[model samples]
Structures are given as C-alpha cells and as structure tokens.
Target: MTAAKKIAASESKARAAEFPAKAGEPAVEVEERSTDGADGTRHVKEFVVLKATWPGRDEADSHKANGAAVANEAIQRGLHPRGEPRFDGAEDHPDGLSLTLTYSVDTVPSSVDHTPGDTTTPRDVLRSEG
Candidate 1:
C-alpha cells in the first residue's frame, strides 16, 4: 500500500493522536532535513515543506500545522532538529520554529524514494568517518 493509504488506514486506530487525520484526509509526509554543510562543516537549514495535501485545506497551511506538531513531539521526546531552531514564517504554534520539517514525494513502487534533494539525512555519510 502507499504511504498515504497506510497512514489513513492506521489513522483509524492511531496516527499522530494530537493531530489526527480527518476522514478522507490523506497523510502528508513531514520530514526534517539538513544539507551536508556548504563548507563541508556547517549545514544549511531551510523551512519545513510539506509533500502532500490535507483533504480540503491549503497544503501549505496544513504543512505548517503538521510540521509544528512533529516538532513539538520531537522536543517532548528529547530530540532536536538537525540545526538551530528558527522560524519559517509559519503561523503555527510558537511561530512554527520548533521544527522545520520538509518532504519529498519521491516514492518507488514499494517504498519511499528519497532523492538528493529529499529531506532525509544521509546516515551513511555521517556513519563513515574513515
């Protein structure tokens, strides 16, 4: 099944309880990403962007709210964004600075296909130090 289908199906039981998905509302993927430091030492950050829609609402607005929700959850779990927390002009709680989640709707036939510009950390690069 597609991510949206999976999310919607699971929503019936539980899916971001604080921000439950309304009936017929597809789950928009929210991601927090960071670049490989332009100087190869410090990463460049950007505001969180949504990759899908939230039923009948504005996609951008939905993204802002969902992104903020994700941030709040991360903070509660003692996790932080990949860089300094900054506002992205989103009017969500705390001004939508808690999290700058981004998303890339690049999926394969069976899984999520995150491309170079996708909002996902390159763990392999970080894991290799030699």
Candidate 2:
C-alpha cells in the first residue's frame, strides 16, 4: 500500500481504539470541501479532528505519533493537512499551499495533594525529629 493509505489506515485504527463505545459520543469526524480559484481551477481540501474522553498517557502519546506521521505523508504528497497556509514566490499568486495537522492531548489535573509542608522536603527531617 502507498504511504498515504498506510497513514490513513493507522489513523483510523487509532481513533477506533481511543474512544469507548457509548451513546451520544463520536470518535472521529472528517470534514471536506471544494472551492474555485480566480482562474476557474477547482481546489479540493479536507480536514480531520479526532476527539476522545479521558485518554490515558500512553494512548495520547500513540495518537500524537500517528497524527505526526499522517501530516508528514501529506507534506510529502504536496498537500497540507488543514488550517495551514503557505506563500508562493509569484507576485500575484502563491507558490504552494497545503494543510497541516495539529494534535493535542487533554488531561485532568492531579488530585493528589502536593502542597509545601505537607511532606518533608529534606531527608534529614525524620532523623532530626527522632
């Protein structure tokens, strides 16, 4: 299979594994559209966003790697992932434009108490007290 195809497949799998099966929630969605330039040439583009609830550290890291791989493949194919813009050398026209992928991992703040003075900062505290 081609590099693009492999990236797509991997991304799909990652999305599937990241989300739990439940009601009122979707794992991934792909949005695509087409537009026309002044010269009557039609330009097609697509963007993808994957959302999951409370993914673990390992899972989030895996998704990040997969997203980067997909973006790299798109760059190689002369296309951008989405929301990315480029400029061309032509005075009236841009040279190249493509989509770029950005991925982020959401996490909740730790509940464990870590306030200062709650725990001994120095190892000698116990020895001094004893």
Candidate 3:
C-alpha cells in the first residue's frame, strides 16, 4: 500500500471509536479531514488535542514528552491521533502555567495573518542628525 493509503487506514482505525476525555476536560473529539498529498492522493487525517501543565521549563519539557507518548498510544488505540505530538507552547494562566498540545495522524499546513490591529499606532521617533 502507498503511504497515503497507510495513513488513511490508520485514521479509519482510530476513528472507529471514541476516546474518553481527561478528568476535567470535555470529551475528546476526532475530526475527519482529507488533504492533497504530495503524490496527489487525498489522504484522510485524524486529529485530537491533549493538555498538560507544568510550573517551570524543566517540568514543561517532561510533560510534553509524556504528552507525545500519550498521543501515540491514542493512535494505537484507534483514537485518530494526529502528528508526532506538538507542544503548543506554554502560557501563564491564573491557575498556573499551562500548555496545549496537538496530535494529528498526518501533517497539515498552517497559516498566520500579520496585519496590524486597528488599535495599533506607530510611535514617533525623535530625530538626531549625525
């Protein structure tokens, strides 16, 4: 079987059942998607998100590795696990420092918009001639 076919088959297996959510979070949802592969075949990709937290950088890295392991396990269990586990970065929240990780069964492109916000203003410069 081609790489695309293998990925599709894996996604199908993962999506065959539901994965229970973590203790405090909502149930995990599996999203079915198809994207054009390099060889022109549309491959189905499954994705889900898992969360982890840490108080410091060392802990965060450890948690991220753990999260990746969990994500891979999800794939083995047919939970539509996507990607090789990604650390979505850490943020400081009222509760504590937290990280949002994404796992996908296949790679996907990402886009970012950089247009300045309406409320943003240019700062004036004080000119000093040489």
Candidate 4:
C-alpha cells in the first residue's frame, strides 16, 4: 500500500491513499479524503488501462473497440492521459499468436499549505542555563 498528496487548488488539496491487499482481496483500492479540516474538498478517482493482442490482424483488430471503450470511459471519469492513452507496445502477433496484457494504477494527495492565510506566533528558540 502507498499514499500520496495531490494539490488541487491554492487553498485546498486532496489526500489519496491505497489500502493494503490481503489474501484473496482486490489488488488496488483507493481511499480518498473528500473534505479536509480547512473546509476544502478532494476527489479521488481511478481508471483502467487495457493492452492486449491476438493472432492475425483480424483477431487483433477485433479488440480495437473494446480497447477504445476502456480508454474512453477512463477519460470521462477524469483520469489521466485524458484523450490519448498510452500503448504498451505496437507489434503484430503473427508469431504463433502469443500476446500479453498488463494493468497498473496510481494516485496522489497534497502536501502543506492547507491554510495559506493563517497566522502563527513564533516561540523562543533558546531557553538555556546549562
């Protein structure tokens, strides 16, 4: 499990974290804070990237629609790579038709500056009689 902070606005930010996976549990799960103590809101979103291949042009082409569908949906959901999704590789599977597909996910939160306009009093650094 990993945690990160993403800055959304000058006065607000989002803290996104993932839960550790246990035996037989989902691999990725995101935990987000919508509202912070400073009266700011944060939204945590997740998207999916699909890469696949098959034997011959016909078989490989068959999955184009499905591939596009996922990327499109991810875009509508406010994920990264908005319009152009990345492809793992561009190669023909004319070789015995062996192929592979991989999946990954990530997110981030914010750091500091939660209350930019707030003020604080300074304390003395030295109070010594050693």
Question: Of the candidates numbered 2 and 4, which has the greater lDDT value?
Answer: 2
Error of 2 at 93 (Å): 45
State the weakest 10-residue window (summed lDDT) of model 3: 121-130
TM-score of each: 0.24, 0.22, 0.27, 0.25
Quantify all predictions' global Cα lDDT against the true fold: 0.32, 0.29, 0.32, 0.26
Candidate 3's TM-score:
0.27
Q: What lDDT tens digits, residue by residue, belong to model 1 across residues 18-119?
A: 322222222321121223111111122344433232223865445444444433333332223232222233323344434344322111111222232432
Model 2 CA RMSD to the hidden true structure, in angstroms: 20.9
lDDT for 59 (candidate 4): 40
Task: Kindly report which residue stretches of model 3 are placed more than 4 angstroms away from their true locations once superposed.
Answer: 1-64, 96-130
Q: Rank the candidates by TM-score, best first.
A: 3, 4, 1, 2
Give the per-residue lDDT of model 3 (tens digit) for 1-130: 9999986676555445342122111122222322211111112222222234233356545544444554444344334332333333443444443433332233221111123131111110011110
In model 4, which residue pairs have backbone atoms overlapping below 3 Å? 4-109, 5-109, 5-110, 6-109, 6-110
Model 3: lDDT of residue 104:
27
Q: In candidate 4, which residue ranges exceed 4 Å CA deviation?
A: 1-13, 16-53, 56-63, 89-100, 103-130
